[model samples]
Target: MNDLTINTAIQTALPATFLGRHLIDGNWVEGAETFQRVSPSHDTVVSVSAKGDAAVTADAIAAARKAFDAGVWSRISAKERSAVLLKVADLIEANVERIAVQETLESGKPISQALGEVAGAADLWRYAASLARTSHGDSHNSLGADMLGVVVKDPIGVVSIITPWNFPFWILSQKLPFALAAGCTVVVKPSEMTPSSTVMMGELLIEAGLPAGVCNIVLGHGEPVGSVMSTHADVDMVTFTGSTAVGKMITEASAGTLKKVALELGGKNPQVIMPDADLENAADAATFGIYFNVGQCCNSSSRIIVHESIAEGFVARVVALSRKVKFGDPMDPDTQVGAIVTAEHQTKIDGYVKEAVAAGAKLELGGGALSVEGLGPQFYQPTVISNVTPDMPIAREEVFGPVLTVLTFKTLEEAIALTNDSEYGLSAGIWSNDIHTCLEYARHAKAGTVWTNTWMDGYPELAFGGVKQSGQGREIGRYGYDEFLEVKSLVMRVGRDSRKPWVKASA
Candidate 1:
């Protein structure tokens, strides 16, 4: 193993184990016990975080509940909330390097990508700030001469935000600021595997002058921490981004309260390549889509449904490109692919690839663990599999890794059929130069967001979420901001002629 290091690292050697504490109400407190985070890339302990449990989860929820009920933040002026959000965005940008490094260490993604996720998240906060100023309801003035109706949007009280490990900071930004913009107080539970950055975000919230108890962070696993957040009576809503299985558990747990649940779950997102499409761009996008974030993205185009006429050529191009994708240390600027989040996850990724190969899917490029010269055995080769059938587990399941599966279709109808065959409807894309083909595919695709000529191009203004089992509710758009709010209709009789009471009581 080489001892070389990138400038992005705060120090050449591993820094002190970051002490992560729970942020409850306005205070940072220690948990019942501390858990250590060993860097998946470097193979060393990088953090020691407070391990919150049911009681701690309850405490954070109580804080958010009190803050919402108190109306300190819930009833604040939109302009004021916007100001705080803007400040938080500014602070986010200022602390990018600090947050990104820790995230890279814990999450095992490239530092460059981590930098982008943290830096890019500022735009989400900025956009949410804009939403705070613009979000409104409708007014129906055409009701009648004496009657008027007003629709008002109010913040759903305490919200529970559960974020995933992959793209942790980015996903949290997708939900948190929007909820705040909508005037909801929240308790956050980041994945136990990647909780440090959320703690850092809590610090920024304090610096941005967010009111005490408006946002609280509790670090721990699903059982007690996440359960309480989802099921608590005082919690008005739950917004979760993770696997569909866990999403189901939260759904069942939240049923008792019937609290609104917004889940951005897993996906088996597909990209269709038409015979008339730009082969080069499609191949390039396919490669990037599968490799970005090491394919640990909910929007990852894990499978490509290619037309039979172009299948062989496209597969060859993607295979050649996959071989060229640099897979190594995440801290290095040039490394395109990096370590998997854990040995277990890496094993899971390889298992899927192996299973596919065993199940008659042909391995086109790579399909197993890769050893970085100086790093631990936590990296996987950029894998590509062709001749994948619609029935294969790899083609249907969420193999959240740098692996791509290829399936073929002779007709557009067949392509659409293959794309919609899965339970996941998070995202799907088509590469076609023909306008009709692209438009037709877009309209017919069951996914929430369809890319006519691109893949996974997201914007804060464009709402994102999935249909079917990929999960419900939206995030990161006007729709996302609306998720944290409730609508109320007010009907008022104008001119107080002591308007129409159905019956006059005891004249």
Candidate 2:
């Protein structure tokens, strides 16, 4: 086996002069001002780029609007559109390794995890291509014999796509390709923290034959650029994936123009483990649930609700498994996990741990940042807390860290009630051998997705979104395509040869 140091691999694998510019209208340019792209693990200057502003954002949106209105790309048939998307997918697959390395370097996720995300991104683009052919219209029966009606799905025009930092490429792929496949032009605003891969995607799309102004990227913070995109009059829809607070702001801003807003926001998802589940497997799954990507995932199983009968065993197993997780340089193949995104985020997560500890919850395994033997800045230990109650702030809030909280429930009803208590319901899981119990929980859990025997498993073929505060609209599957399109009802008079209705009424 190749035993390569993460830092060494990173230094050798990635060139220092990698591109760090915004992609707008199938071309790259420096913004008005500049911002540094710092390495999350070592706190070093990875690169710097011109800071994009509202003007750049507005320019990108205008370009997208022109593309949609001018029918430069939107007027293509579904088959032709699918071919373009398929070509993009092929390009992504061919460059998965480079993209994966970029993702790991910027986002501080394990290299293996980044690779998975890259492959998943390819799958997502391919899935969207498949869906292009399936965007169908429905025929409806009318009241009169001569009257016929149909509902055709049409593109929702220019889309303002603002994606989060954690899974930059993967998340943007989830939103953008489907929008394009639905015949919409897009203006993308990837998070400044991890904008490299997203900008790379723009170049790849251009290489894959995407026309100018069809897909544009403006990299910057959310305050001005994102705000302008959300509030832009020409933008027909806004799709944002980020904090719940910001999502609310986007919704409010979009409301000013009555633009359709699709949000994929925060989650405090619960994982209920019944007495009959395999404790070892469930514990391992739960460990990966929160520890993956250092728990930056919106759907990470943060809440663990175990049956009273096996809570003790599950907690012990989870603690042992958490200890076994090898936290080292992300580039090392042996490293199961890597650093958190930034020092500020590490401090924020540590604060959450401290609060949970102060609130009388037992910090079973880890509860603090780790200055690991060879790592720097953005590293933290995997955390596990037990004996947590529903009322604690840590239990209810979205921590967005590698932290897991465990609680016990005596009955199935209690488990269901506790799981449904959160305002966020992005996704949840139920682990049980009893089919009836699993089925019941799946039916009652107030999340967008419910897992019966597994946790944190997802596919490009399935639709994913949340209800309530977790955000609106779906991504990934056929339902994801529907989010970017609006249904237009068409009516025709097929058999109205005589005007008998008025005559009969007069008689």
Candidate 3:
């Protein structure tokens, strides 16, 4: 179907009844309390979602634990698990339009972007399903004729998955599918700001024939639910994607039980453009990297460190492109830049811009909140601040909005230095024609993933994660499956006589 038809169908068939409940133990359970979900695109109530507290969180954890220990899912063969995951991927693709609509309404991302996210999520699930069958361990052939050593990867057990509001379904797909592929039962806590899509996925899991308690969805604030998920002894692992501050808190909570923790945290990613770079392509990529998803992505290239020779021209091109971005209703397929996820986030974005301008950074483009006649007040204009230094808070901190800061460097060494100076090492990009320069930066950049002449490129086959304070552990590809698995070595002796005489020699 065409885009317009799909959008119209979604609006007409809004699934409001799907809200206000938690999926636990293969049942839709009501929460003790409910919270109204306000759409940032229109400032209207989209739906009411269950606000899971400690009791509800505990129930979900118990369910996951039971599922895992009972071997209802954990004992399934790799082929069986792969089939289920493939079915889930198919279900996601079938409901792409509806998923995209719900995601856009909840997260205030443009409908087009939401569609792309849904597609990416489906791809991730399929990739994970393939990995489920191919994930294999090693055999030690050099153990000699009398001994055999075999290493096998087994499911870690119940996993607690915490996802962020921005790219909600996409991030959940990244973690949940891989964990399930590895035979791990999961208790998912989607960001309360955007929980409807995940709750709907609970239904999809049921339809996909996932066993009871194999996956549970709990929606609520971070305090009680998240605390329980991270600290609960039944949870074998916690996979989180959000702010670094919250990631640290989860890490501390998980320390009590010593549960495995996989975090994909925040980033103030840098995009370096050398003198020989294609100015137009670099500007385009930089603009998309920062403004896409309203710059809420952890790997958003917010920092553009250009060589002095081409700094002014590149900044001018980016500013011109930024001004052209359409800021309007997220539901509109044509919208390029949508609303911030919340009013508070809009304020935060504006505050960062104001602080930067006050601190002497020149505002070359938008620097304030945008108010469309029919849309809500959550929209923030695509902003560009020039002449920023590395020491400035705007340059160092993650704004999590459609805000870009421009800085200049004289040498390649200085560019690498500026990129690695931040505590975060999530992702970065380099725009240069010279292969040597690209290779040098790719090797030295502290970020987990670096793109040459491109920005924000990702694939399911690639391993994505951060380094340093950006967080630990990897997600996607075989490594993502490894996160949910525990390796055990089995050693056996065949055709050997047992003898123990070391202690008897003295006697």
- TM-score for every candidate vs. truth? 0.96, 0.95, 0.96
> Residue 292 in model 2: shift from native, Å?
0.5
Ranking by lDDT: 1, 3, 2
Candidate 1 residue lDDT tens string, 121-239: 99999999999999889999998788889999999889999999998899999999999999999999999889999999999999999999999999988988999999889999999
For candidate 3, the per-residue lDDT at 59 reads: 92
Off by over 4 Å in 1: 1-11, 496-501, 504-507
Q: Which residue pairs clash in candidate 1?
A: none
**TM-score result, candidate 1:** 0.96
lDDT of each: 0.90, 0.86, 0.88
Q: Which candidate has the highest lDDT of all?
A: 1
lDDT of each residue in 251-327, candidate 3, tens digit only: 99899999999999999999999999999999999999998998999989999999998888888899877766666
lDDT of 2 by residue, 35-86 (tens): 8777786556665766788888888888898889999878889899899899
TM-score of model 3 (CA atoms): 0.96
RMSD of 3: 3.7
> For model 2, how big is the CA root-mean-square deviation?
3.2
